[model samples]
Target: MNQLNVCLSPALIPLYNVEDHIVVIIDIFRATSSICYGIENGAEAIIPVSLVEECAAYREKGLDYLLAAERDGKVVEGFDFGNSPFSYTKEKVAGKTVVLTTTNGTHALHLSRAAKKIVIGSFLNLTSMCDWLKLQNDNILLVCAGWKNNFNLEDTLFAGAVVEQLKTGDFKPDDAAIAANDLYQLGKHDLNEYLKKTSHSERLKKLGIEKDIEFCLQVDLITAIPVLDGEMLVKLQ
Candidate 1:
């Protein structure tokens, strides 16, 4: 059986053999969720950059790229928007390209670039992502984009959810994956209530973006899985 491993935080990524595994980057609070929404809404592609400046450079190239940057849970000034799924409506993003940088999510994507293949994951695309993952031949690494290299509850919970689904497939869960699956079993009944006190949730609550939280927690709302192609995340076709 292919082994399924969960790296609880990006800081733990160096310990994993990413190049031999298919990496699913999870940032359920916003980034990966937003990616799923944008791609489903028909955004041509989303480029994930680690630095805000790198996202900005795309603007100078004179392409009509929509730039998005977020830091500490708030949209950075001078960008079109941050990592909010609602901002990626079909009316807005259809046929456009988005250049994005976020405090946690994009950074995790950068760290996992050496993976055999990289895909974005969120509760929004949970079922679709797992269904596709079950058909893959490589070992799987679910890399959570925890808050600033430190473990956080929401991301871990999402990793656990994936573990719960994939456990019945051709995958064998490692210790971390087992722990995550257990966590998911405990919290799957009411995700919003389960995450009420999480650090990232509190941070976003303070910013008054509770809608983003509610939307991100919804299961399988989006069927598109955003897979990395070169530096861009496009809907798996």
Candidate 2:
């Protein structure tokens, strides 16, 4: 692995000296997409909470919040909204604040407590995330929200997308991204088919969110970069 810092999960990422690497968090299924929508449509800020209770707590702190959460591909109880970009329509969320929680994405944000700087990544902002990474100092870590603390292809594939773009940078792409880039290059001709092979696709199909999968798999439709400053993910200026 060399001096290239890499961690699959925040829970597993050892606490060490990593004040330099760019930490890109990927939740390709939906959370990042929703983040894209919120930032693109002029939402004030999106605070990502690891738990529903956390979101509620933030709302109670006089934030004037819209609570959004999702679990197992469905909305959670006692929340203002769910994890869908469609729900973040400009008409509904523009000029407002949001507290977001998700089964995977927000949890991933919470886990990276030791990251130097955390940025949300998805197909939509693939280029922006990488371009930002290119401008940072040496070393980079791609934290993937593996399904239930296990290896997940979709997250890694998104990481690979970043690696592909940083080919000539002073970055140390993890081996996971190496393999992921291989898969991405091989199936790039029919990305949908490749995405269907991921565990997320199976779960989405079972949850009847095949359409969501389609929406998430749409690449490069947006350039909005959602950056995590503490628990809140806001538009990257």
Q: Each model's TM-score, in the order given?
A: 0.95, 0.88
Off by over 4 Å in 2: 1-6, 15-17
Question: What C-alpha RMSD separates each model from the true structure?
Answer: 1.4, 2.5
Model 1 lDDT tens row, 168-193? 88888889899888888888999999
User: How much is 197 displaced in model 1, in angstroms?
Assistant: 2.2
Report lDDT per candidate: 0.89, 0.72
Q: Point to the candidate with the largest lDDT.
A: 1
List residue ranges in candidate 1 displaced over 4 A.
71-74
Clashing pairs in 1: none
Ten residues in sequence with the least summed lDDT for candidate 2: 1-10
RMSD (Cα, Å) of model 2: 2.5
lDDT of 2 by residue, 56-96 (tens): 78756876788887776677777788887788888988888
